[model samples]
Target chain A: MATSVEQPQTLIYVLGVTVIFLASALIGIMYLAQIDISQEYTLYNIQYSSTVSRMVNSPTCFALEESFELPEGYGTETQVQAGIIDWWKFNSGITKVCSDGRIIYAYLSSLDGTLQKQLLTGRDPLTALSDSDLESIDNWNTKQEKYYVLVYKDSQLIPAILEVRIKG
Target chain B: MKKAGGAFLTELLLATVLVLIIAAGFFGIQHIPGFSLEPEAKALIQSVGDNEICNVNLLNLIRSPNEDGTLGDTLITSYLTKDYTVFNETTTNILNQVMLRRWVMNLSINNRVEATFGDPAGFVAVPCIAYVPLPQPFFSNCSFSEIQTGFDGYEINFTTPDGNVTMEIVNQFVTDSDKIGGFGVYPTSEWTTIPETAIIGEPTTINDTLNADLLILQIYVGDESEEVLIPYELTISEPSEDPDGLTEVHLTKKDLVQQCSIALNLFVELNNE
Candidate 1:
């Protein structure tokens, strides 16, 4: 009777050990899975950032006017031929080639706060953007992306911002 | 006691075997070819190609002659010999070429460096570099032929040391009903409102001795008075590789125009002189 009782106790102890081992293994696996997910996220973020950078720096942004022919007397005396921008064509070009699911805004402005020309897609044009809107756009929260680049407009390097909201 | 010990040992062995099998499978997934790194590699290659194009565009801008009558370091007014030297140095250094065996620039009155540069009708300027990697091949072997039909523009055929590489730069001019005449002095031809195609460069073929890695830049100065379209096509063949599967990179007329516009704008902005 004593041996039978001891056998039951030993079997129970073995079962308890196996349960503990399995639980630890599961926890270990979960930890590893979390690490892998984190790493993949980081890699994806890097790739996304690079793609956005390339888009911003693309030559299409600074495309010149179809023709640089000046009006008869415009630059005759100075002979200074400043490159002109075909704003409408450029806007369309960027829209067609830009990655989908992202809102893009391009603006040419003077050094002062005056807006010259603004191109917006995927959002309504606000006559004036409030500070809060700018904040939300810049912060990018979780699913959105924002990038700003400067292109030379004549002698001035004008700032152009591209904001994208990632899609599922 | 012996029976219990054997049972315990067997359980331990089975658990160990299971663990090993799982670990092996987990690590084995990474070794499969083209699984993890192909996307990254493709992205890198594309980035490199774009960078190369940008570099080449900048070099072209630097070599272009300034429009003003005053001659700074502009290549247009300089002696043809000096122009050749500058081209050689720039191409060799910027392109990282082993040697620029041959170089040529064909210019017309419309696209000449400046008004004073003179109208060189059918003039082909060849560089004076002495470095010839191979004996000059016969020009007939690499002459420009109308191999394919339906293309309204000019085509040039050349054989690189590696193999045959064909490059064609075409510009189609569409009449703008709103505007009369063409850009500058060249007006649209009266026949069918279709502007006559202007071929600026000479038909020079690359000597087969030249390096396989070649850089070709086709600048299409379109007629601004009307809508101008430029289409550029390049086909490259690796002699060592299968000729049947030729690699070609085509930039549609629209994209080519955009590239030219962007390049010109950037060139103007970056011009220090």
Candidate 2:
């Protein structure tokens, strides 16, 4: 065979192909990495005001049944009176896990400069969820009767609601 | 020797290319899970919940009224309609006005959902953390339901296709109850003696031709974005010394006046209306 003469030509072809291939590969890799983060995020807010109007015309049952009453330290006049309590932030996430392996989580977000709250404990762990139990609090199921699932990101108000009950 | 060296270099290049291909495939496969929509969508919801919390809380604080003259009920109505209530007093006053910060609210609703898809019927879905208040006892089942007077619970009505949830919510503020002692239920044009109970003081009713003046429990609802244009109603009933003020501080028990009958009977309607 014509060994020496063909060697350099073959090397040139290989070099050209390799360059194009690596370029395409890099583009594909970066595109894949960004796919999950591309979509616009919608925010779901839950707010309340000392002003009754800022509170929803109708509150979720958990709060209403509780008579809008809070503990002395839970940010009320009594708590402030005690002079021990300091600041307060509208909280969201897991509250308590029932004995029956049910989970409950609270979701509070902002809407039109007011606090609007959403509460739920959804089940149905993603089939893809591994046993690894990652520390993704924003993600992950609690131990209460997972009821509602808020589907959104960050914008103005809560976006969508999905049921989170674990069914057979 | 030169040929040997060249072959070695060729082998190294081939190995490196192979490794590159394997690594790319591995990483490419790892990304498939992230592409799935559910987890991302859920995370977005969680983030939205987190992002808006601060704004809502601040809004709540700004909208809350102070003790000097701008009481909560007044400022809250003002806030509903977007009326900016400027702090008339200096910052020192606000900081010193400890009563202004004492306000808190909680929520409780009677959630009635009729489960149809092979589940139990008349199932109620009540959420407790929806409280606007920190300490939650004030908002009880009675208050929300209008069943038990002091916010006992909610009355839930539900529908299916799109579950129409009708609930009564109880929002409460726990002031220093002890300070609000001896609130004489004197017959202020709005109260009356419950027929049998002899009022300690001579009862006085609004002499004018008012409708339902015998009961008084004023409730007002205003469009939250506008400050001035608000709609409210004053209700009055057999007025005698009654629990006019709700305070949480320490106070001497002068003499117990009256109590809003554990009945949610108070409604807002005027003679003209």
Candidate 3:
């Protein structure tokens, strides 16, 4: 009779342990799901935003800059204007100076569909690799396209779109 | 006692195995593609995309090139010509390449909507707004002047004795005669006549000289009515060339406040990621 009673008590203890384990596991999964969701896009977005900012604001990129003669013994000074694309510089591949060892392709097109320019900067690792190699990595890349960039051409401010594709 | 102990150990092992199997299944379901956190991830992406478009993209689209002129220029031209093909196509083409979201663009002139692109029923949201002033239209030779003068030596003949009498004659668009003829010239092409009312008296018949460049206002002084004729000459000359470079009316900022402006709105819908 004592053994039978002890058996039922041990069974209750096992049931209690299983319930606690399942509850804890569910909570752990919920916490991990939140982190996974945020981690997926946050890093990509940060990199994308940074690349776009540098491309538009940096003089070595497509930014418009003007040179003015300085007075006295001072040398001429250059002023870089943000949010303006120098049409001549853009067409002349001056943007090649913007290559900073990363794979990026910047495309610009006038809203009127009359003008388009594409520049590829950085190393072309994928070009050298075989198709099978790319497929192995799942062909990972992030693309961001923005509108309302002003292209300064012939004393006119032309509206345009700039698309940047970053390859990982 | 040994038998009971053995059964207890077996039952504990079985319970442990059952819990492990359930946990494994739960984890497998979570790892399935798009099964966990898809809605949250989608919402975040959509929010970022929309914010960029509102802050940066719409501004550029208005300033971007459309054809022989900027996109804003094309919009104005399209507004007047009723041919929105160029503006609509240029904008849609640029946006289509980058975005999959459905959108609608509304162009309002002087607070009144003049052109709309995209289906009205497709999307609903507060639009991204941008304003572009219409290019000022140039008129070579156009003049407007109003000369208020009193009737001098002109006949003041009113047949009414008592009560009130009023007469008004408005001339629109100065004709050749009004331009070549001297001060009393009236427009013959477009003339607006006000019906005269002579209360408590017969219909007033005034002389042609009284009708020339004159507006008669008869006021009642006690029982007796006194007639007064005021002379005013308004001269409006049509432009020698096209009046408004874009349209027929002379372009003025005051007139344009309600009729001619390029106000653009872009309403975007969230696309499934």
Candidate 4:
């Protein structure tokens, strides 16, 4: 009778050890998975910030005032250059003359938020990005970035915001 | 008694087998679809983070623009006379401490400015020391000699073939002890020495005699080059009435590229402690 009682106790002890071992293994796996996910998110944030910084510092964006040629109806070369600068002050347009990317959209607006222009490549204001993608830009989180550059507007240099969103 | 011992040992063996099976199942979950490790993602994140840090550090080394949008004189002197040994040591420490990697910093300036005025001459070439990192045996295969002891700051001496253009970038920090406060570029050739009084409390001038229609100063920190341009017509005259007047020079958007851009690249490896 005593031997029978001890047999059940040994089985119980063995079962308890097995349960503890299984629980420890499960927790370890979960911890590793969490670590990996955290690392990935950190990396994504870094890439996003770097991309935005690069766009803001691009030389092409800074040299936008000197990028246009004299349009046919815009007087002489000097007048045309001046006209382009003036137009950029209030008008939004896209230029095919991009150094790195396929298209560059230059958005111009006055400080008082009076005038707005959106120029698209090929003289069409439409962009290749879907409406949803463009709308997403309005709801940019801290990850997305926009740079406001001072462009020539009349005699004063006004601020023009340049937002670059590259989609595949 | 023998039968009882056999049964106990069998129970222990069964428990061991059960635990091994459960552990295997838990660990094998990572092998499931969409759960594999992404080494590329981790590397991309690390590289971008490293590059951004390097950019910030390098920009901090440059002189800040004054209230009037002109670089100060002391800043220029410090820039010219900055000890590379100290710079490299500081940079390496920051990078290693922050990044936990063995890395080196390389600096090279490319002054190739195209003439936008007068006769369109070719690029004005400023000879630079090739990419040389401190503590030899790392990036030792460089064309130009490393900075030696007792060496004065960098000197950029260039004269166009026509003798019309003569430009000299002397180490003002070493030459003149008094002009040591602000940062700027004072054109001091063998024939002409710009008085410190001219730049004191005045807008730093890009002398009209330099004949440089456009001057692009490129600072390369690894493979990346950040260029700042000094255009053909950037002259701010001294105030006639107030000798202590400040000349406010307006900088266009084009000038901001050089001032704001941080272009530095560094290769970082994970430090296995």
Give the top-scoring candidate (TM-score). 3
Task: List, residue by residue over B190-259, the lDDT tens digit for candidate 4.
Answer: 2224222211122234343332212222211111122322222212222122222222221121222222
Every model's DockQ: 0.05, 0.04, 0.15, 0.05
Best by lDDT: 3
lDDT, residue B192, candidate 3: 24
Q: Check candidate 1 and list the clashing pairs.
A: none
Query: Residue B147 error for model 4, in Å?
Result: 29
List ranges where model 4 is wrong by over 4 Å.
A1-11, A27-54, A63-108, A121-144, A152-155, B1-273
Model 2 chain B lDDT-worst window of ten: B260-269
Q: Give the per-residue Cα lDDT of candidate 3 at B38.
A: 64
What would the per-residue lDDT of candidate 3 be over residues B1-273, giving only the tens digit for each residue?
677666677777766677677767666766877576665565566556565555456666766654556777887777768899988888887667545567777888557777788767864343678777655442111111122211222211233222223323233322224323233243222222433433223214322332232222222211324453222222222323221211111111122233335778888775444
Q: What DockQ does candidate 2 have relative to the true complex?
A: 0.04
The residue-by-residue lDDT of candidate 2 on B1-273, one tens digit each, is 466456556655665676567567655765675455445454444433322232323233332334533223333333334342432122223222221112122211222221111112332111112112211133221112111121213332322111122323223222223322222322222222322211122323233222221332222222234432212122322222334322111111111111101100111111110
lDDT of 4 by residue, A1-168 (tens): 797868776776767686767676776767566544455466555545544444334333333334345533343442222111344422434333332443333444433465565543444444444576456545544332233334455555443343344321
| TM-score ranking from best candidate downward | 3, 4, 1, 2
Two-way DockQ contest, 1 vs 2, winner: 1
Worst 10 residues of 4 chain A by lDDT: A76-85
